[model samples]
Target: MSSGRMRYAPTSKLFIYSMSTLYVVSPPLEIFEGLKPELRQRIVTLPDFLRYPAGRIKGITRSLLAGRVALPRRILYYWFPKAYFDCLVQARPGDAILIYEACNVRVLRAIRPYLPERVPCYIYYCNPVGTTFRRPAEELQAIRALGYRLTSFDPCEAERYGMACTGQYFRYPEHQPDNIDSDCFFCGLPKDRAGTLQRLRTRLEAEGLTCDFVIPRTPAEKLTYPQYLDRLARTRCVIDISQKGQTGLTRRPLEALFYGKKLLTDNPEIARYDFYRPQNVFILGKDPEEQLRAFIESPLAEVPETVRAAYDVNEWIRHYLP
Candidate 1:
């Protein structure tokens, strides 16, 4: 199928290239379900090679070779080139390819030689800088050298790594519930902040406020995307505990806006955004109990439609895949 070009602005010289197909090279994520119907149909999700028996054996062999300093882990793309080649070869001119995170460096490397010159390749980094899981600077530089457009939700982190800041996006619900039952809700892995989150939960319950806090002890305990959204929809306020070194906006803030639920967060940097309102978002700090109590008693504030539309899934997809 032939793709088309989308003009975003009259004054701008840049033209957003439309894609006939999108090859998402990442582990399965529920976010893909939010894609527009036309775009969703063209998606091709890549499988995790380490999940298969043959692929698992290859992974072990590669790890052993890298452990002996014989081969750099990044240059071991030849070991798993089939998946990369399969997708790359099918990408016709004008098609778009998105690779999530820097962990897919080996796949990107393997596909570079097979990639169509006219096809656009994009890389998205969702993690913060200074993390062991993040991509190496040299590897990112090499990817950029190969003409792949790099972007990140963390604007500051993106700039530090010389990538474009695309911000974050979330799927907007078709219907918004009018009744809110719970005072506050939060669900996530209890990484290093387990103690801090537990204390907050205790304090909220002590004040007779209803707080639905979930820290999954195991993978099976984790809530599905729809279930998580349902909880957020029923709550008057949502709590966000940002990970260490996190400077970018997470999905919580966007969800809060879409649902008109107040936000209780520890990220001080959120106040800098244009959408920040003291009545809508309460930053967690000293005397959080006092702040939480005050916020819970106040009426929810309305977010401007313009601001909300800026982060809408349709708008975000246009920006990312246009």
Candidate 2:
């Protein structure tokens, strides 16, 4: 959300105020439930607005052409749900628009014609490049050329790409988790981590821990957010395995912090975060098995609700919009 965005509302395009609203355009993920109700209204998922190919061949053709042929890409994207674009055209210059990094530059280019003048538009990366995204440097340059600012959740990635390092967050409902069906929980694409997750599960089970590790083969096979969170609510510990080269704070650690579940991750950078407590977080490689066992056995530590709320999407957007 630290990515600067261009937003326009119903009225005047004037100086930014403390209360300017934010509009987010992201990939297909329901991440706004944790935001204050009013903030949720401005969020939009891109996939829904984009026209779906009627059949498999068209889908494949579109996928094949969207990246190479600019004319076809714009022609395809220009056909996106009109109402969503209308919101942008009508938005005042003062509002802020956040376009998640997942939305490619082609999509950004397609929307350029409708963008309000000097409307702050941002490209925020929730995932690291080369890991989940293969966007080249030219793409960032093109994005900037179109007057959009770039930001990332991972500090290392931000530094590597010359982007603003915004903290990764979880948009989860604020409530104490009461269920406890498993000792550990994990759900994600294998992404070269299948063997690692399997071995880790074996070790945790050897430690007498019941692990609910869901290693889906693809994103489509992944569990829904509600299903994943439901599993998290029933677990005592949340597993945090970064994509092969990533060392960023993922949603797993944040989920652990907000839900009072112990964190079991390979990301040592988490130690630098304020909410990180050794008693509650067990670094996969750095911490000993004994420490991990203790962390698992000990009751989860308490994190203030206020601290959890600080990660809310509303608060995150406010930092950039304000």
Candidate 3:
């Protein structure tokens, strides 16, 4: 497990051989919309069962079953026979196969036996290990055994799993306004941190700061990706509360940099990154209220164009799939 700090660029041979590519991505297709046109055209996506009603039901059922039963590694083949068949029939020698988040464990297993020995296989894990709802440990090991090149968003987790770390990427917006409506913004599942977040909000409000803190209790309350970004663009600062055991940077900080907003995060390790600016980012810890107040009052600094470009989806794709 090398530190994710190491960069991966595509070799001349890889570009020459990767004329055809298969992408087995999870739902919410808009995330990959920023891919270069040529790369998008070269890649084919597998069926996302969550997009259809019957498939959604199967997904929910499988999730419930997975909570109570340890499913066999190959069960996904039976659950998603169409996807398994498609991967087997569509993949060719020298083709590139990119699997996002190890979400489709069975498909990976089923397709492994059929993948041409010369083909390049890569799996990117967006979530930290042990956090996934399915058999994460087993699935990761299976992916390793099958010779897939693994990548993770979390640098520490990448090292723990012995995988490459490709930090999170964001789609650079066509236009981002300088005007801001709120002093601070945050929206996410509570993940058992509801009380702490609520208290933080209360404290901020007591300081007379405008905070748009949202902890959606229902699915309808959740914002779409675009809606989330829109809200982000309207805020002066973004608050990031890392999940337990998470040391990797999430997309929030990168989003702040892209939109020119300040960041207040509990992830102290962010201070180690090259792009970290004390004037722009405040790590929450002792006397967080004081830190938050000062950070809000301070002028936002200009992040270098190179730093911003490094996290762009276009650059990320070039590194991962080049």
Best by TM-score: 2
Q: In lDDT terms, which candidate is top?
A: 1
Residue 93 lDDT (model 1): 78
Candidate 2 segments exceeding 4 Å error = 1-20, 27-30, 38-78, 172-177, 218-221, 304-306
lDDT of each: 0.71, 0.70, 0.70
Model 2 per-residue lDDT tens digits across residues 1-322: 4233534433332222234445566443556656664554444333334444476876676566554545432355445544465555555766777766544666566566667876787778877777544665766767778778888888887887778887777766555557689988999888778889988988888888898888887667788877888889898889999987787888888877767788888988888887878889898779997666778989766777788878766677665662
If candidate 1 were superposed on the true structure by all CA atoms, what would the RMSD be? 7.2
In candidate 3, list every pair of residues with a backbone clash.
1-162
Which residue runs of candidate 1 sit more than 4 Å off their true CA positions?
1-19, 27-30, 38-55, 61-85, 132-135, 176-181, 286-289
- Distance from true position, residue 134, model 2, in Å? 3.2
lDDT (Cα, 0-100) at 289 in candidate 3: 64
Q: Per-residue lDDT for 13-56 in model 3, tens only?
A: 11122354544545235656766776655545554432222567
What's the lDDT for residue 218 in model 3? 96
